[model samples]
Target: MDVRRIGVVGLGAMGAGIAQVAIEAGFDVVGREVSDELGTAATERIGHFLTRKVEKGRLAQDARDAALGRLRTTTDVSELVDCDLVVEAIVEELQAKRALFVELERFCRRDTVLATNTSALSVTEIAAATASPERVVGMHFFNPAPLMPLVEVVRGELSSDDAVATALDVVDRLGKVAVPCHDTPGFVVNRVLIPLLNDCVRVLDEARVSPEALDAAMTNGAGWPMGPCTLLDLVGIDVHVHASEALYEKLRETRMAPPPRLVAMRNAGLLGRKSGRGFHGY
Candidate 1:
């Protein structure tokens, strides 16, 4: 399939980064936000990110200009109709996503592929809402999508081989490593990642050591770039809880159970970097 135009149906950090990546890859990108205010914020954020790349000599001036030129921002969902692919990166709600999929089906062309950026939601369940389930795949890009190297090309029960091939090709075009996985709970990265972070929470709950010391042990001993608590703070406690609960409920594993510390942090409204507080205060 010819993928000349791309639609990003959200302008959050991840969505904006995906838009930037698409634009940089020479595709005409339409980034949709629910409101004009948020759209403007996203546009400025992308502009700043690209400008930084230019300043760091990572992106050429003319190339950055050309990429930005290819980007269009809109509040209308109808603008996505001509796009060859539409990636929905909106809120992580099943009902909301299903409704959007139903609405998108009405506007998207027959051959246009619809994908979700959902991190933990059941891709099969999301795909079932569309008339063409085979066309719906999970194109799960990591957070800060432009910088992240890994992109999980998830295949739902109803997803087609052609769809998976197309998604992998797109991932390659975006300069990302593509790892295809069955649409299982938490997919691959989150399945292995979140539980370990929960273990860190459990360790802290024992009060045997300070968060600072635990973080140092992991980073120094394990050679991790960032320790579990630090990473969780960066990802947000609320997001961790959501992913953890989703995985635990689906897998029925005690290891996936979110520790009490995570619940305590959430109750305290220490969401993480977004809220400026978490396991470690921002």
Candidate 2:
């Protein structure tokens, strides 16, 4: 389970953090994006994130330099041919991810582990599209990947025990807690957390309480770090919508369905912090 070169196929927030964590864990990372500009920006953002860590005395300057030195950026997915592991953190689109895995199979070696950072989607479906289904697994890192300690090592229907072991080894190398799970919708954390957040939104919609008051009750009364609405805004309304849909479809439970206000908010483009508005202002 010696991981050397790692490839991250997506430059979004989760991808950037995963790349940072990998680089810091002594793995040479190649970050691939759809465009050159995005690749460069993702690289710069990683540098900035590491710089902040150094400023906070959490990471040494020499270590930061070494980590940065290990990072490579490219717009060509084929450049990841030599990578030992490639993790896809792209948008939660089944067709898009399936297409990418098929393409990756053509370029990468037979033994290369193909993992998806999908929070909610069928790992079995994703693996079905790849030539090496046994080697395809889910390495779901939580939001703010560098900061979160939990990593869900999901075993799809066709994912081999070796693949799960390899993913767990990588999780240990990254200094995160690895929780092995089947290809269950929402896995473990989001399966419970998303519904709670949705319930919070329902509470607001039902006139049970105001968003501010509800948030305060959770934080102050329940001793939560942040209110549900605040966390929802940070998680992005669109992300919640996708996760809710996945859960509802799998469990066939109304409680897991996305609240009306959330769907309306997303339809109106009020996608929380990313869109400068949600339950709260950006």
TM-scores of all predicted structures:
0.97, 0.97
Mind giving the per-residue lDDT tens digits that candidate 1 earns over 34-139? 8999988988888888999999999998998888899988988888999999999999989999999998889889888899999999999999998899999999
Which pairs clash in the backbone of model 1? none
lDDT (Cα) of model 2 = 0.93
Residue 3's lDDT in candidate 2 = 76
The RMSD of every model to the true structure, in order and in angstroms, is 1.2, 1.2
In candidate 1, what residue range of length 10 has the lowest lDDT sum?
Answer: 198-207
Q: In candidate 2, which residue pairs clash?
A: none
Cα lDDT for residue 36, model 2?
A: 90
